[model samples]
Target chain A: MRRALILSLALIPALLSFAIAYLFQRGAIADFVWSGTYQIDAAGLFSRAGLAGSALIAFILLTFWWAEGRAEDTFQAERNMQEETRRRFFRRLDHELKNPLTIIKLGIANMRHTPEISSQQQASLDRIGQQAGRLQKLVEDMRWLSELEAPRLEQAPVSLAEILADAVALARAAYPDRAIDLAVQQAPWPLADISGDRDMLVVVFRNLLDNALKYSTPGDKVAVRAADDGQWAAVEVADTGIGIPDADQPSVFEELYRGSNVQAIAGSGLGLALAWRIIKLHKGSIRLRSRQGQGTVVTVRLKLPAPRD
Target chain B: MSKPTLLVVDDEADLLAELKPLLERSGFAVATAPDGRRALDSLQHLTPDLIILDVLMPHMDGRELLRRLRKAGNWTPVILLTQVGTPAERAMSLQEGADDYLNKPFDPIELIARIEAVLRRTRRGDAPLSSFRRLRSGQLSIDRQTRQAKLDDDAFSLTARAFAVLEHLMLNPGEIVTRQRLLDEVWGWEHAVETRAVDIRISEIRKALSAYQPGCIETIVGTGYRFIHEVVGHA
Candidate 1:
């Protein structure tokens, strides 16, 4: 309908110009044609020129509107194509990379069980195993990121406190040297149950706590606190670590984005991005506050389901 | 008596090969199969005490195999293995009659521990159903044969580990059961330097018990816990 309106509006000026020049100025035009070199009336000539100018302006406006719409359509199609390619590439990468990594890890496990290996050879094997583990983690993260791009969450009733506890246990086990504390201050009468994908939420909390531990030094305290309001449950993961710079805060949740000050830190930089996606899928919000040289605090708020009778 | 047999079915040749020897070294007679079909074939020839089934494989998957086994009235405890499982998958596996599951790249020691726990639970199920004595303290009662516990009107359920802990505490009422002892006896974790798991499970048991009688499990500061039996006919 809009296109039709634009087309008609564009033609109206041209039609009017033709009608005015031909119908009203017929006599002057006829006289000029008969005499071959006739006297020109400035008023009629200027009127005719004005009508032609209006027609040109209308046509230009129509062209601009049409071009803008076309550009947007092309951009959207390109974006969709790119996303599909990326998803497929990652899926293939995950399978190809993980299978080999699993085999290598299994081989390493088998070798470790052998009793005839020398200490030097064992050290080399251990190094290979550690590198293989790192590669496996990287592959897993990439696959996870791809999955998060279009997640179909299997929502269920899950306890926020239980998820927090599990995340803390995982972090502690991963980094045994670090002191991680989980403090649940205000729990609902019977622990608040949030309607969400439990596994995805676990990944969210794990990533947050993992980040807290990754950027911090040994012996640094990483604290996780959870509390429930009447309608929402809030969790905070705070750590005394090399905090993100002010300039880098906005981009922290961007895919593959890393803080400028974290050059020395080993990370794939997909942790926060994946967390943001999973939280968004659950209709939750995550916020990060950091002051360089001080610490970083990540706060997440998730909607709680109504208490069941 | 012959060692209890465990049939491990996995498509990964290298993994199956490595796991067979490791489990054998741990003192279990291990059987192997490449996939679900072969596993079913092996089952016909030998009725293993337990089965470790891999979730993803050619032809028939672990879930299908478990379904078939349960449908056939075979209740041999089966543990499913997955690469990276979600909680929903784990819950579904358990609902489908999987005794337990282990994620890939798990520690061999942890695998052994889980296997032992499952085997023990299954063996208990096969014993004389009601012949075993039920231990009682005040209003609380624990049936060793059924692995069920009751406190007054509230008949609460417990996990295998929690039930084991409760049974041990009730068997030695008034005695201060140390965390180390509980870990060693209930979990069979002899070298578990960290007793945090014991404390966590104890707290869980206490919460469950609180439904009927609060403070039945007393925390002995700086030590472990004591099951303080309530006096009969007391306010």
Candidate 2:
């Protein structure tokens, strides 16, 4: 509607100029056109009309430009406001879920300590505690996702090799049955260091390794390799597991998005999204390559500090 | 003999109620405080052997209370309790003088085990003479009397638990001290299935020593760390 209004207003100046020229030629300057009466110059009349028409068009164009700018400003402001509101909602939700989850966990712990409970009752309480622990993990992942969306990382000199080692050890501990290997093929004496938040980077690697281990079988091999190429330090986590489908690869980094192959698996689907956000925040990139039946490999690339001359 | 007393400070009334009875069952005279202020006030009259403090609390949190206690020259062992903590938070808490920490919704049995370990260390410290008094390896020297390490003339401070681990390693130089042995000896945790706590402290100690002397503590793959015996002189 506004576009139509602006278009009509733009045409009004040209229309008025044409109408005035027509009236001047027909009524007021009839003799001037036909017999050149009263020494009226025809070229002068056309030039004056042209100048007036240009002025009117310039005024209309300036007004339209200003209005369009205002509309864009309103749009950007609304978008930012909506984003802030969504972020706030997630923060509040995380806090609310965390407190109650803590309470439930404590309650379960208290019940388990009671010696009077039967074995059957104890088993049921164990299940409850396990489920609550899962809920707590989900809540933590959600909170971490929100934090990644708007990161406030306390960056410092962190050893990539150490972080990878810690993550690999943790994954090995968590999934003792799986065959996980860490190959630091080309790490220099102390390994290359990147300026990043150690804890956050650890979380990123842990999430990746956890996903790789979760989707794989007992005999499947998961390999993590780290190397530096002067400008960038890179780590690749590869697994012989169920790979993501071709159609689902693009949307895997989306929040809460699960693949069709992962229906039976229990997951929050926030792992890759969190990893992507964290890597981006550190001025790095993560890439994924996989075949349907083969396996998946995730490579995270981070910039290394320039070597001293 | 009187049982050792423990002060449990948490904002959760239900948790406090539940924990008090459990600790009493484990044979400790337990004192309860809802916040840091009350805990500090209780310290004036009651001298507990150890303090189990919740990190997040109303009106002065555990970290602040610990700083205050350390600032006031109270060297009572403190074990921090939290819902979930990052490595950085754990490191920060250790740096602030907490003897150890446990995650929330922890098994009661585990808490008791940690408490016993910390209490044992505190008791040992109170005794006058121990077998290992002072150790010298190269320029590095550790004095068990003052619980301090000096490299040449510069002194480097370590957390109580880290110091104990270093002392154990220094005493048995060149021996590959297994993670389990360190956990049992330094942490006093007998049935510790998770040895990651030991790994973290070892990592911290390695970081502290990396600047002055690198590779002093050698990590033996699949076993443990061996503190190299590079004795130059005894201070």
Candidate 3:
């Protein structure tokens, strides 16, 4: 189709010059005799007319190209402005939530020490404190998503095997009573390291591992496998537990999006979204594959820093 | 013998009201300030044990007050209460001479912990642990040059490599030590692919000391480990 378009574009100018030349030579185009009143200068003027028509066609194409470029620049500028606006909105939200949450938390902490409060009131405060904690975590994740726009990453060479091991350890620590079998498969070969903020990358993998643990039940197997293709290091977190419904897979990375099937499970629905944002900031790509009631597999790919001479 | 005094500075009157009683209950003689100028005014006559400054304020924010206090040669410990931001921003508060910082909406208990940590460092005159010949905390003690360690008056049997790792940890208690740094200092490897050796040594130390104290050495996931106890170093 592109070639056809180019061919037509070329043919339009040629066809016009041909007709112009023909009108000069034969004084008509398909029986229109508009050349009757003018002198039929058939000699030496044909090339000039064709050159003039070609110049006009080139000028029009140039104008269209410039206009398209301008439109794209405008589009890019608008996109950047939108991103900044979103960042500001989140920052303001974080500020608005910060003081009130602190006040509530401190107020509860102070009241807990009051001697007059009964056990039932203590339990109620505990519940309020727990729910307040959940809100705090949601706001924290939102802040992270905003900070990802202009992250200050401290770059250093990092090991993927160690990262997987740590991530698995954290997951196990979080659910010590759960009988899920969590394992980290060491990379067979010495994988090249990637440069990134160690803490930030840990947050990404921890989020992924937490999701794997949170969604699965007892006797389920959650495996973290690390491998490298000599250039890109790929880590896969696979779980043989309840998987995401096919319908919810597409919107998994949307902020505050929780899978409808797993509403009973405790989560902020921002884990995967934060993970995706962090990976994007690290210049890596992540992909997810899952089947409802079967299992889920998430793979993260990162380019290894080039070896120095 | 006397209660530690803390000057709390913030713009939120409700927060100030809420925090004053909590801090007083925590055994601190609390003095409240509406903003930085008043905080400075309190400083003219009152040299509290510590200052808790809020970062975002109407006039003279936490950073400015921190800078001004340091500029006037006042080395009083200050813990900045900042909104959640980048790690680099937190690092900046420290660079501007804040003893510590806590993100806003933090647990009041954690604020107490940070305050104690800052006071501990300042009260000790910020001495390096390596300067002392012996390090002691709780029932754990290590003789620096002799490479001798004891836990609960029992011999802490650790491999020489593990001992080196433990000694390094003792010298910098309550700070996260990266595995690569352990490998560099203890194993003497410039750059090695395997950091699992550091982990193995850490586990060895933990196992040997588990009977006496199980959780002294904490693994800072995905980075390294931290010796979670406060070790006093002296001759």
Please report the candidate that would top DockQ against the real structure.
3
The model with the greatest TM-score is 3
Alpha-carbon shift of residue A100 in model 3 (angstroms): 2.3
Error of 1 at A158 (Å): 14
Each candidate's clash count = 0, 1, 0
Q: Estimate each model's TM-score.
A: 0.52, 0.53, 0.62
Better of 2 and 3 by lDDT: 3
Backbone clashes, candidate 2:
1
Off by over 4 Å in 2: A1-113, A132-206, A216-230, A233-251, A254-257, A289-297, A304-309, B4-9, B31-110, B113-150, B154-235
Tens-digit per-residue lDDT, B10-51, candidate 1: 888977777887788889999999999989998998999999
**Rank by DockQ (best first):** 3, 2, 1
Off by over 4 Å in 1: A1-106, A125-251, A259-263, A274-309, B124-205, B211-235
RMSD versus native structure for model 1: 14.9
RMSD of each: 14.9, 14.7, 14.1
Instruction: Return whichever of 1 and 3 wins on TM-score.
Output: 3
Ranking by TM-score: 3, 2, 1
lDDT of 1 by residue, A94-189 (tens): 765644665576667778878899999899998998888677666756666565532346466678888788778878888988899888865346
